[model samples]
Target: MRNFKAFGHVIIALFIISLSAWCHGQVELDKAPMEKAEKDALFSTIQGFVGNWWNGSDLYPDPCGWTPIEGVSCDLFDGFWYVTVLNIGPIYENSLSCAKNLEFRPHLFELKHLKTLSLFKCFRSQRRHQVTIPNANWENLAGSLRSLEFRSNTGLIGKIPSSFGVLKKLQSLVLLENGLTGEIPPEIGNLKKLNRLVIAENYLSGHIPDIFTALGDLLILDLSRNSLSGSLPLTLGCLTSLLKLDVSNNHLEGNLLKEFAYLKNLTLLDLGNNRFSGGLTLSIQEMHSLEEMVLSNNAIGGDIRILKWENLHNLVSLDLSNMGLNGEIPESIIQLKRLRFLRLSDNNLTGNLSPKLSTLPSLNALYVSGNNLAGELKFSMEFYGKMGTRFGAWNNPNLCCPLGAIATSNVPFGVKPCQQQIKLVESNTNGSDVNKTFYSIASLCHAPNHFWWTFPFIMILFLNSYIIGL
Candidate 1:
């Protein structure tokens, strides 16, 4: 009886083990195959790029040792798996100057599910030489890509591939600080999904594209420091969503367009160092959100009165230097309670310095040099001394000597006498002899050799005056 019971117990244990194995198989089968393949590709790409030393650096969790890589993520919806985002910038290594030799493991393109590709510092190609990014490798990339970032690729040279515009789903494109040369492709305007586009610090040349005006969704646009030339398109006003617009350091020219008032949401507008000319219009005051404006080094001419800065309460830095401005330093600037740096130098401004400038609680740096400003440099100098600030107003020829004390270390005392330390008795005797000679000369002019007559005439005149008084 004991042997039969022991055999039954063994049978039950075997049955339990068999059920557990079947359940594990079901769990494995439940995972989507396509998703798994995509994850594997992502994992391989990271490992190949990061090298063996970074096999498992606690970046992310992966059950199959292939799902998680740093800066890489995948999403699955409705049983369909796709790479929703890939921010593999911080992990890419670029040692070779040639971008082609930068070792971008082509396997990354196999991630057919990729939607966002951000690989900053990936361009390793040297100047003038075209580094061929394998366009074929991206052949299988899913059509869902929405955003792409390739920033800080200083060595990157070559035009953006026309194929880039084919990314219909692309929303935000950032390719800043590259050595890219040539004109910005007009096809870029085809990217209707684009909102924030930045291509600053490149050697790009040519006119601003009117298609950019069609980008109503564009919120932030920076095209500074390029060799781009031509007039700014009036269509720029169409960007109603623009929050920041920076076109500084280009060769662009033309008068300030009134259409600029359309960018109502603009917070920071920098048109500095361009060839833009003409007078600043009252329309500039329409920018309600303008916080920092840098129109320095342009040929902008005008009165500060035309600009309504009441809306610019948040202004922090205002630079209008070398713009041929002529006027008094506006006391209205004192209303900018948040101003930190104010530069309005190299202009024709003339007026007594604003005392309000010294009293501004937040004002730190104020430069108003190379102007017709004159007055007692006393007010300005005393203000500087009180604030412990550096003052510079060196070259106003009309400015007088006391004010010229700014150029001196110390003020000198009274001038020294030509004859030093004559004996008192000798000086008195010399003075008396000089007085006698003076009287002799007076007598000769009145009447030659008539000293006695001169004395009598003097006495007679004194007596006549006394008689009249009596």
Candidate 2:
């Protein structure tokens, strides 16, 4: 009876082990195969490429099975594998060239499950092909496509299609460094879900559309290095969620509107190299979240003292170079504890060097050249010497170095050493009056005469006094 009971226990353990192995094998076989329609679409798109590996053989018989295609990702949907992302370019480590004579294949749009598509340096091979992006067909993927990017396609030209507004599901759209021309379509505002829109380094013209105000969810809006003109629309302030706004290197003109201050979430604001002409707006002080504010190479002129620098505690870089700003460098600027770059060069500002500037722990670059600043620089010699050429205080004729101060070779190029002036006294007496005259001249040397006219008048007064004494 005991032997029969032990034999039954051993058989039960064997059965449990076999059941576990069989269940594991079943799970492996259950992985879905790539859908036939999607696989055919991918095959047709890369068929013209010379050395493509998507040849649909037993080795890569299944793109989502044991074998995987580079830069293509798939996911299981309705018990079948579907291509969800396509990154076609030389993005792989060993990949070198893109398709040489390739054209935009209509089969690419057949991937109904595609959610993301990125093509980098793939369309512009030798500048021979004049590829134009298809506009109306893009709406076909609007149900699933969330991100689309086309970068560095030199041959791409023509106006952006107004049909792009139909892609309501798109969350990001980037088309940078292309040969695209014409105006930005106002229909772009229809994409309410868009979080980022970058179309920089193109030849796009025309004024920015007021329809952009509808994109209240936009976080980054970059349209720099284009031919865009006209004043900024007041409707832009409606995008209160904006973090970075760059419209630099354009032909935009007119005064900066106070409505910009309403963007409380702004971190960076760059409007450099534009044709804007006006006083620096005081409304800018309301941007407490600002980190970098660049307005260089414009005609913005105003007193520096009007800026509320103390409120901008998180400010890191403030560039206003060649903006024609005037007035003294306010001491309140020292309150910006996080300031790293301070460029105010090529302006008409006049003030004594603020000694507090050197004490800021984060200061790295200081440019104040081509100004009317006067008086001795009171910062430590060691600090000034360490800055090298980054410290620009040249071109101020009235500004002079302290007496007997030794400057390094790296000191500002146009700065000159302070010269000590001596008053000459004339007396009628012969040898006896010589000692008294020398004493009178020596006293005038210690007198303060920073102004050019005061030194000559003091010399004449000393001469008259010495003659009377003799």
Candidate 3:
């Protein structure tokens, strides 16, 4: 009876030990597959980047643990290697693609860990008597890409594909200096993580997208140098994070939107070379951080009252050129203590040249040319004596004396004598100076000749009288 009980106990103990061992083995087995899966996924992503269609050259068949291409970086998380960045710009631009039909690699979409991808200066190889197309597959880009830049691709064309919205993780998208055309896709607003959106220097047309207001996190929005028409969208003020906004060089027109006052964080704003009209009278009090402001080449017309510069204490560069501004350049401009560059050219401004501009210690470059500005242009001690070659104001038709006459103005400053003749052409062509000079010379010559002829006759008459007296 004792032996049988002992045997049963031994059998039970062996069975329990076997079960524990099996459970441990199973856990070990499960971890190996999980780790393998992660490694495979990462390797696959790296292979995709290497085999990208844009990289027509077989330069990098395997970038992982090899002589990785320049601008390309990899990161190893866990036991897997993944491409964190693929700056294929240098490779694509350096290698010439002679392929008749260039194609963008769809394999790049497999890079699940891609964080940044920039394609700059990717030019196609020159072909003689053959028409070659560009290799840009915007749709095949990895959705995991956080930052994508395709700037200065001189040969790039075609409309922006709507599939761009699939990049949910995208934070920045720059497509500047391309030949892209067609209307902007409203689906661009789908990038909730987007902070900077640049599509400048393209042939894009149509109205400004109202959906852009959904990009609440946007900081820099540049759609300049496009054919976009219509008024500025008032909804653009919703981007509170906006630091720089450039919609210049477009066909956009209208007055400065009242909603622009809400852009308190804006530092650089450019509305130049547009058809924007109407008076600019929004309270700029909240724009304390504003540094550079350009409203040049617009049709904005008014009496040209300048607000207090004390509020714009941080202003560095201010350009109000070609706005049909008439009236004196306000004395308040000198109060902008931090002003470095000021341009008020091509306006109908009439004012006495300000000596106060020379007193500003921070004044570097000032351009008030092509205006009806009159009065003596005085060269400040700081301008001629200290900061030489930094002052420039030309083509002010009414500004006479020193500036108009280059010979007298530059000579006093110890400027080198010009080897060429200095001719001052008066702006008023109807002046009678030429006629006055002709009449004066003719009158002076007539009097001298008449006196000489009459003097001979008088001498002869006196001789005859003396003979009669004799």
Candidate 4:
């Protein structure tokens, strides 16, 4: 009986040990496996762009587990770890920095699951080491990428890659502040899912592709600071959901299109510093959702009364400076209670300003300089003080400050006080003696201590003396 009890105890101890070992094996099996192909591709990509000195195996062995690369993230797909994000720039502290001779490796596109790839301020302008974006293989990332950005890379020169259109899943495509040249390719019209397309501050030229109509879901489309020309496409109206559209500082021309009114949701419409000519379009009155409208530095000539200024009730900033505008500033503009910055300078405007402008709840900067405005500014002392130099009513030869305004009001810059007209008497005598008498009489009248009561008496006496001598 004692031997049987001992045997049972031994059997129980063995069973407990076996169960513990099995649980340990299960834990090991649950860990996600890193594929050898993915690891090799990732290492080669980093080596190609960040320089060959980086050895991922020696520095970060388990890239998805115990050790991780900065600016790199991963996801598990079908029990294997895959890289889903790779950022090459100094955006974060201790982030991977691009080498001076950065080159795109084939392995980069091999990152099958990459959803976001950003390179910011990495390629400083070095002509000898200039590199263009990969001309092919972008289709590999088209299946999974959601965002791609290349910002401020001056050395990354060349025309924009047309293969970028293959990124069917891309939502945001930003290539701002690069040295890219050549016309924007029309192939980008294929990105029907793209919402934010910003290609500003590049040397891109040619007409804004009318193909933009296909991007119905686009929200922000900024092509500003490019050398693009041609009329703004009427097709832009198709982007019904667009909120901001900036194409300023281009060589575009033509009359303001009626189609612009169709952008009912657009909050900002900046077409400034272009060559667009013609008077204000009748359709502009319907852009009630516009919060800021900058049409300055164009040749848009018309009076303020052409359109009912009261229609833009949501306007906060309105810049129409240097656009050859003439005529009176209508009182209807004061209906814009939200207006903060109003610029109507450097034009041929002729009129008296409305004191109601000061009453605007948010009026901060008011510029009416370089016009033909006349009459005294009647803004409140507080208004003048608060605005100070922000009120730029200068270069108007006929405009003047209110009486006694200089003492209290922060008089609008470059304005003069209204002066009383002084009439001078003409002498009839024609000899040198007559000239001498006139000079003496004028000097007496101008004397600082002269009495106003004696001025006429002195002038008459001098005239009579001159006649007697003649």
User: What clash count goes with each model?
Assistant: 2, 0, 0, 0
**RMSD, each candidate, Å?**
14.5, 6.9, 15.4, 9.3
**Root-mean-square deviation of candidate 2:** 6.9
For model 4, residues 77-115, the per-residue Cα lDDT tens digits are: 987889999888998998878888878999999999999
lDDT of 3 at 248: 92
TM-score for every candidate vs. truth?
0.70, 0.84, 0.69, 0.83
- Decreasing TM-score order of the candidates: 2, 4, 1, 3
Q: How does model 1 fare in lDDT?
A: 0.68
Off by over 4 Å in 3: 1-62, 91-101, 123-143, 379-381, 385-390, 402-470
Top candidate by lDDT = 4
Clashing pairs in 4: none
Q: Write the per-residue lDDT of candidate 2 for residues 143-170, one digit (tens) a residue.
A: 9999989888777777888888888999
Best-to-worst order by lDDT is: 4, 2, 1, 3
Q: What lDDT does the true structure give each of the candidates?
A: 0.68, 0.80, 0.68, 0.85
Worst 10-residue lDDT window, candidate 2: 437-446
TM-score of 3: 0.69
Error of 1 at 128 (Å): 9.8
What lDDT does candidate 4 reach at residue 27?
A: 59
Candidate 3, residues 201-269, lDDT tens digits: the string is: 989999988876678999999999999999988788788889999999999998887777788899998
Error of 3 at 166 (Å): 2.7
Error of 1 at 247 (Å): 0.8
